[model samples]
Target: MLFFSQFQTPFWFSSCFSRTIILFVFVVMCCHDDIEAALVLPNNETIPAIYVFGDSIVDPGNNNNLLTIAKGNFLPYGRDFKGGPTGRFSNGKVPSDLIVEEFGVKDLLPAYLDPKVELQDLLTGVSFASGAAGFDPLSAESANVITMSGQLDLFKECIKKIKAAVGEERTATIVSKAIYIVCTGSNDVSNTYFLLPSRRSHYDINGYSDFVAGYASQFLKDLYGLGARRIGLLGLPPIGCVPSQRTLGGGKNRDCYEAENQLASAYNAKLSGLIDDLKTVFTLPGTKLIFLDIYYPLLSLIQNPGKYGFEVATVGCCGTGLIEASIFCNPTSIPLSCPDASKYVFWDGYHPSEKAYKILTSTIINMHLKEFF
Candidate 1:
């Protein structure tokens, strides 16, 4: 084992050790004034708040109250979180909470439908995401979750509440200045088009990608019209590489499902081009639209797990780690979850572990922070 003290620190260490140090420093900085000091941009302008809209990737607890099977409000879900299971899909804080915390805005991004959310929470923003939601309306309809349009309707209500609380001017400032994060489309590719025959019978992979990208374009346009000037749209990750997809489509040996991955890449390509076009065509002045690429970052961690201090990248830490996810991953399962989640890239078959999320969030924020301004 290697050890070092504050005064006798070595100049070199293993890549994993260095990564751990970086993550440790990041967590430490987030504790107090250090986060503000470290996150100071050149312009000194801070994000007023953060509003999230997407699927389970960003959903905190919106699915808890909904009559949907996509819920994750049970043990081993938020087991690592301070408040216990609050409906987050992962073991602890999801990307929605991480983004807000990284920006020093707040500790958690409460779900809009959460009863605990107060007027003060609305000013800082709340998540309008639902588990299993997607850009395609049918995807959500099939899962009995909120659709993209339905989330927008909720957002409109949220805006009305904010306006009522702080007047129109302040609401406008908060809406325009705050960062809006859109992270969905995984369920659309992995579930609706591939697994379900309804869409596949009518549209091929390319056609379906276009279909989803069209809806995504419209969503961005609608958000822009609603006074959202700064938007961070996340591209789909490697859905095929997740454990559940691997078990289903990766053949008997369980390799990465290339077909689903290709669909994700195609959709991302189309969405990226659309975002660029929207900036020049549909967007008004002062609009900052960026397509955050989560594909390669997650792919990197999976392809080379040791570089990021992860031992199990192909499976999850929950239950069997091959097929268990959401409700399937529970305490009553035959075998309990792994004792140490830090060594795993995924918390469940579907969602990344909290440690992996922190790494991804850091990579994404570093890549796009300057572009947002």
Candidate 2:
């Protein structure tokens, strides 16, 4: 009787039915947009540049100006990179370059140390990541290199220089409007937390894991306070899977260094929990603070090479996994050349190949960004 009465109601009563139809349409649109797409243009808001921070994996050339011998500005390193290597730690370009490229950045985001870069480079983007950094600052300090916090200081210095050049108003706009991408933590485990016998004696693996997560959380909070309205926090990748680490324990008869890889996996899990805690601290609208899981994606490539397109996924083409990283990664050092770089996942012993870097960037953009833009 109620249904019949409603259907038989006057034409003026049809507004509710119209609202229902509108709501149905809105639901359909929302469903289609469920994946969030920061891949799109900055909608109504400002996202003119990207600020890159982390270790050599994402470092552009922060070490170029420094007198450190750990530099990638030489040939063979950038021979395939836009006609010449410009100190990027990767074989070709890294994620930092791929991001600005995919976003259709007009000018190339310059390394903070590039003398050729103008004051306006900061507007497009600027790479301030040091060659050494992790969840802890001690890794870099122990190596006598710049730590993550030290890199942030370098970023601050760049900001100051930019302000002097472009005035406070424009500099403020550039810093506030850009996206902050931070990728760190691997170094801390390999160097400070794991490599240091003193640290191992002090903190067990779980204790070290908690300590790392705590440091990461605090650093992220600092970034938030530094006018980083939009930020993408990348968790640590499978550190044990790196060729160098793999060579450390195993004799190739078995498989991976399961112990280290499991530690890395556990750390990422803890990081996921940390991100959840972080969200409660901030409930602002339109502020993106997402944790991208590169480990899963990169590990997928290693486990299933056919998914991406590769024959060999295990070994690096550069040098024998034995003595290829650290003091051995030299483009000029023909002694380090591998037979087939494309087939292997890692380029050298430590970092991924250009192809692998490409996949990492694509996965982060396509798999993760559908919701955050």
Candidate 3:
């Protein structure tokens, strides 16, 4: 007994200590993939899904299959994406995709038009945005792109599929719990109102802004009818500051078109009031409508590029960003793109780069998304 006790102490301690060290290493290696997944998927995810809408700013790849010039399913566009050229407008991810990553819902939000997208993907989330789409029907028509109404129709179809897959009860929960983000209206201002001259001739800038706000309000009401409870509506960014607009319309100095800036400001104010009215109108106990002010945030990023670690604020990385966009942003035609896209705020004339998007989303999360979580 005495000999056994003395031998047991050393034997047990050495065996247990070695086993613990080996176990620790083994566990860490075993969780290698899980650790990576966790980095993208936060543990504190509160939303069940994130449904996104709007123009190129949020379109994943819906326009990839569309027969429009607003497509981006080619090189240099998705140069930084995993499989490359997934039809996102930026060098990599867009605002909606980054927001989904921020919410820890999914690494990539599938485009509703992507044939590979499965029922499971829909249950999680999807983007119904079409590049070049706008609240104004004419803006969409001009680009030969799907209008906001058409996108809403697609959402209706999506709902039907969700109901078929998970039944009505689960579908309702998903729709209610999901976060809906809208980032349209730039095209309405840039394409329809300012460039076209039709709307501009009829309604003054203020009247035109009010007209757009009315349409925007109707859009939210339509979503509410579809069971969307939590909403994030991004106001217009500085459309005047976009490289394409500045080049085409900015006259000699190439300064941001002042009249266009005034138009955006006027529209934004009306839109803010519209959002406030929407909250009261959408009276579903927990319905939350958040109007994200991207105008100032984006403008500040442009005015103070160094503050945000960006070198170029006016031009994009693809070709002569002063004019290139969509098909014009083709790598074949340009034969070269900026080696480093992170330094540039705009990806190609209009859209923000993935780095710019990440910064914008982080700011939005810090400022407003805290309540949602």
Which run of 10 residues does model 1 get worst, by summed lDDT?
1-10
Q: What lDDT score belongs to each candidate, Candidate 1 first? A: 0.76, 0.62, 0.72
Ordered by lDDT, highest first, the candidates read 1, 3, 2
Provide the lowest-lDDT 10-residue window in model 3. 1-10
Candidate 1 residues 317-357, lDDT tens each? 99989988878987764267888787898888888887777
**Residues 101-190, candidate 3, lDDT per residue (tens digit)?**
644677888899999999988987898888777777788888887888888899999999999988999999888877787778877777
TM-score, predicted candidate 2 vs. hidden true structure: 0.83
TM-score of 3: 0.86
Best by lDDT: 1
Clashing pairs in 1: none
Best by TM-score: 1
The CA lDDT at 184 in model 1 is: 86
> Which parts of model 1 have CA positions greater than 4 angstroms off?
1-38, 42-44
Going through the candidates in the order shown, the clash numbers are: 0, 8, 0
lDDT preference between candidates 1 and 3, better one:
1
> Candidates sorted by TM-score, descending order?
1, 3, 2
What lDDT score goes with residue 314 in model 3? Answer: 85
